[model samples]
Target: MPKSPRKRALSSPHDALFQWTFSQREHAVGLLKAALPSSLAAAVRWSTLRVEKGSFVDRALRSRHSDLVLSARIGEGRVYFYVIVEQQRDVEALMVFRMGLYMMRLWEQIVRDQPGLKKLPPIMPVLIHHSDTGWTAARAFQDVVAVDGPERAALLPHVPCFELRLIDVSGGRAGDLVEQALTALGKVVLWCLSVSGDDARLEREIARTAAALDEVLQAPNGLAALEALLRYLVATHARFSVRKIGRLLEKAAGPRAQEAIVTTLDEIERRGERRGRAQGERRGRAQGRAQTLLELLTARFGAVPAEVSARILAANEAALVAWTTRVLTAPTPEDVLVEDGKRPAPARRPAARKRARRS
Candidate 1:
């Protein structure tokens, strides 16, 4: 089944973006480092060993894991790395809360899992936002701090954050990178991925963009990434979000890029169509079942009101599903009510009886 949207809040845009861009856990790590500064990138070893935990809020507690993790040996001390990629086009203030929770959990896990280790390394939370919201200045936990007194203020140091703004690097810069990557038709690919709707106009823009990319970067991978991007757009049926665009870029890069994008896009579309059909069928069946029950109620209760029928139809799915299931075993409308776990109060029976007697 195509996965339903994730209900729990995500840690950061970094984590979300990582999953979208690179399907594989390890690839996300490599790609992340590539985007970071050279000094930090060189010291780190991207580890594929990921830890999974149950859903923080649910009963089944399904596992949610990190996007990429690594350990860096810096000045005789080993620092642990945890990165979450996000590609949201809008601000999500709630992410701070989610990240705070994840950070606490990670700290607990580190202590429990590695008892021999003396100390934990400074953990850096990185956010790579690709939104038209345009990049806001990078912020860290330290930035929000307030020292009420002079003594308290003296002890605190600014906690630097690892945040990168890719939006600052625009179309012209992107084309230059494509040229260096030696990809054929690089800019064309980028424009196609970025352009919204209007296929004919987009095609013209793509051709022009491709020519620009050719002017800058003459690399093969650039071309590959571009091609893969086009195929992905043609394949997947999603609105163009920054995260989706990043995913398309990742899907487009490499030797098998074109083929992979085609396959994945086709699969996503097929699964989406199937899911829609299944949901429709479920809804139709539920409606059918409810209609049958309404007819029975009208027959047994002597003309059930239209308002009551609408209420039943508009009821929640969980309630509707249960009610529909009960209808199969219920003998009458009264039986359906009890089967649905609704029972009349004994206190009301005398009044109902008096009213019926009077009528």
Candidate 2:
């Protein structure tokens, strides 16, 4: 029998998002360099990360391993960057707490190793969210505590990292970058940037990416790799179009080569299209469920605050759809903020008892 997929340690609704991010390391690194135009970004030439976990217990505790860690060239020296990319499709409020533990571990590891070296490279915490629910406030909890009032004050010495919400990148923006070659790293960064648009623009961008992919595939000795990438893109693109795929195939490879490439692309597209449609249906159900939960909240609490409602409404389609079930099923608003069952909140409390004892 075929073996089951490996179970991730931290399974949240954004599990797919996390998995997607880790798998695209090249794309992740490209994004890091592009987003931050600092010394680390500029000084770096190439990047990669050590992803293995040793068997020793101490290694597990002391090591500052991230889902995706990148090492970049900084002129004469190399700087290592850690990214804790969380997918907050349905769990927005919880990151307020998670950022603390993640940042602490990284900082602690950096501090412990400082005596050996004159200075340590900068470490960054990046939260990339596809869902709208988590972007309720400008700052995640990690961003708040690091600040020592509005005036200048050195509280933590190191700056707390910022969060990037993919849901904010719109279709128009996706169109702007679609024509660009974006290295594998660029693709990963673009994924986050693509989070803001509607299905049509998303489809257009996917087509553009597919076209670019065709170029890569047509590259000498790149057929196999390009085919694999196309398969992945088809699976991920929610509104994949067969005609677009066919046209791209024809354009990338003339009539003679089209047969072979088209055949493979077609098979993958058919399978992926089916899967994508099912995913869309599931998202629809989730949205409906979330709406019902919101109704319940309104009945019980006299409507969720306008700010909260606006944020929730502003959530991107992918995230809003994914979290529908979570919002409806979750026990409390706080629960809605958490990914999966893990929470930063203390133990749940019993509701107040109505008093009518002997008086």
Best by TM-score: 1
Residue 213 of model 2 has an lDDT of: 51
For all candidates, the clash counts are 28, 5
lDDT of 2 by residue, 71-144 (tens): 55566765655444433334445553455565556556666766676666655545444444334544444455
10 residues in a row with least lDDT, candidate 1: 1-10
lDDT of 1: 0.44
Clashing pairs in 2: 27-184, 27-185, 92-134, 169-196, 286-324
User: What tens-digit string does per-residue lDDT give for candidate 1 at 164-261?
Assistant: 21322222233112133322332343333344243344333443443444432244343333333433444332455433543443433433444544
Per-model root-mean-square deviation over C-alphas: 9.1, 14.9
How do all models score by TM-score? 0.53, 0.45
Let me know the TM-score candidate 1 reaches against the reference structure: 0.53
